[model samples]
Target: MSKTQQLSKIGNFFRAFGSAVAVAEATRLGHQPVASDLRALGIDPVQFKSIYRR
Candidate 1:
């Protein structure tokens, strides 16, 4: 793949991984939710929440 494509793939991987981790953490912290988990992962809660919701 071209450099840009490679970078895109990497970005996609991280995004998916982050979403999975956020889901797991949200399940673990019953009171909190995936948005909070995304925040913990250093992502903007609102934006990440929107992405994860998709």
Candidate 2:
């Protein structure tokens, strides 16, 4: 697959995983992670923050 497609697949996983992580953290904090913010996966394709959180 092309680099773009590869990134997208990775992005999808990151998006889903990140959403889950955010939701978990938010739940602990008494709030929910907004789904729209993570939608950046479509435009930005992988969030470095998600792939390499520190």
Candidate 3:
């Protein structure tokens, strides 16, 4: 996707998360929770630095 399209998708996710938080105090995700899934676990999400991305 183009940069703009990627940003739009990220915006959509933020909107979804905002709505979800408003609807319920907590959001659940399937399987074991990893560091990346922390947001769904009602905690702050963190991004680890990868050689390519960071």
Best by lDDT: 1
Residue clash pairs of candidate 1: none
- Score residue 52 of candidate 2 by CA lDDT: 40
Between candidates 1 and 2, name the one with more favorable TM-score. 1
**For every candidate structure, what is the RMSD over all alpha carbons to the true structure, in angstroms?**
7.2, 10.9, 11.6
Q: Write the per-residue lDDT of candidate 1 for residues 1-54, one digit (tens) a residue.
A: 799999999997887777777677775665345564465556676654454331
Cα error, residue 38 of model 3, in Å, equals 23
Could you give candidate 2's per-residue lDDT for residues 10-30 as a string of tens digits? Answer: 988887778767756864676
Candidate 2, residue 15: CA error in Å?
A: 1.4
Instruction: Kindly report which residue stretches of model 3 are placed more than 4 angstroms away from their true locations once superposed.
Output: 25-54
| Each prediction's number of clashing residue pairs | 0, 0, 0
lDDT against the true structure, each candidate? 0.65, 0.59, 0.50
Scored by lDDT, model 2 comes in at 0.59
* Arranged by lDDT, best first: 1, 2, 3
Instruction: Tell me which residue pairs clash in candidate 2.
Output: none
Name the 10 consecutive residues with the lowest summed lDDT in model 3.
Answer: 45-54
For candidate 2, what is the TM-score?
A: 0.49
